[model samples]
Target: MTKLILICCLITALVIRINGHRSSIFAAAPAPSAPAAGDIVADTCKRAAAGDPDLDYNFCKSLLQSAPGSHKADLRGLAVISINLAKNNAQRVLGHIRNLIGEETNNTYRKECLKTCKEVYADAVGELKDSAKSIDSGRIHDARTALSASFDAAGTCEDSFSDGNIPSPLAADDDYYQNIGRIALSLAALLDN
Candidate 1:
């Protein structure tokens, strides 16, 4: 009878141990799951731009949806795409500014604004290139620096008109470049984490 009791107790202890192990397995933290490809851009953009009042979620979603590879890209891929967009935007703005300079009238304020825009947009294009290279090399600090500089360049271009008390003809273009810079910065921040 004593042997029978000992066996029962041993079986009980074993069952308790097994149950504890099973419980732990279920209770432990789950591994981080990657978002689905179609959702990755929106998810990452939402998280990255959470604190930025200037970043509209729906605008970001639409932009990402229209970007190449964005439909099926992961976070890293999104970062690359964002940088490319910044580069393209800077180049496009630079061309627009040059055209404005060529067609600028005798108005001193307009001429000054065009000249400032041209210089800043040129600087922005170069900075964006640096940002892309820095990101590619995994140099987060350098990339952030270049991205921030690009953002500043766009702001400076817009501010030239504001500071001079003149209305900016390139307001829409400036806004577009600024938004692109913000997107790039947000993506860079995501990669930093």
Candidate 2:
């Protein structure tokens, strides 16, 4: 009788543990629905204008679904998208540099940066396809380098931006500065390896 009771208790405990683990896994999973269109659009627009390739490409796609006859908004969206895409592609060269640093074989951070770079690059290139010759490659390169540096700089960059210590027009270009700040932060994170 005692053996039977012990067996049942063990099984019950095992079942409860399994159920708890399952619930925690499910809780961690993200919902299937896409992000809200408005939030995506606003965030993308703001980021792009400010020169943030990561956020710019992320939100840019949703802006395409904006209501018809909103040509002004569309044009603004196109401009931001184009600029960010250019910056994204330019950053790829930096990714290669990052990969070659030390013996870190994981490359997860490099992958994340490149993923963002590709998305923004694709969007910008697509939008500017008609007037590709007008785009300034040098400016794009500068923006990308700045972004990479910003990531390496991390908290200092964030503090500068938050405290308005950086120049006004430059500060207004948050995307550009933020990306550079992020690159500095990423580099800092990589230092642990």
Candidate 3:
């Protein structure tokens, strides 16, 4: 009878020890504190707008605000939105170039310049489109390549006139495209995290 009691007590102690160890092993680790929703948007914009005199916090905020679900966009979403905005800008400028070409029908020199600008702008549009796609699919390297190409295209368009000692009528447009491309590129780099 004492042997039976001893065996039962041993079994109970073993069971208790096993359960305690198992509970300790399965215990959840404390989670890292998450940033507030409001802080996320502000921090994202502030980081984007930082270090560029031309880009202020308000500009970044407004840019993000123009996107759908801007309030809820995380860092990746912000990068996506920036790429989409750059694509939209490229498309708009392409149309503008076409209109400018049509308007320059009577001036041969202006017509030629506009034609060259049109070709480069088309290239820019393609790059922007590709970049947007790559970014949407989370391919940062491909997106960066496209953005680099876009920046080059804009620079090429602007330089084409300078090479010929002629003033570029599309300087403002080229600058705008380059600026947007640069901002998109910056956002793309941030996606590595």
Give me the candidate number with maximum lDDT. Answer: 1
How do the residues 1-193 of candidate 3 rate in per-residue lDDT, one tens digit apiece?
A: 9999999778766876877643433346745677754565577767766745566576666666767876788787778777778778877877887888888757687777777778877887788788878878889999889888877866777777787788887788788777776667777877754
Which is the winner by TM-score between candidate 1 and candidate 3? 1
Superposition error at 174 for model 2 (Å): 28
In order, candidate lDDTs are: 0.79, 0.40, 0.75
How accurate locally is residue 3 in candidate 2, as Cα lDDT from 0 to 100? Answer: 100
Alpha-carbon TM-score of each model against the true structure: 0.77, 0.21, 0.72
Model 3: lowest-lDDT 10 consecutive positions:
21-30
| RMSD (Cα, Å) of model 3 | 9.6
Clashing pairs in 1: none
Report the Cα lDDT for residue 161, model 1.
Answer: 88
Report the C-alpha displacement of residue 28, candidate 3, in angstroms.
31
Which 10 successive residues of model 1 have the least lDDT summed? 21-30
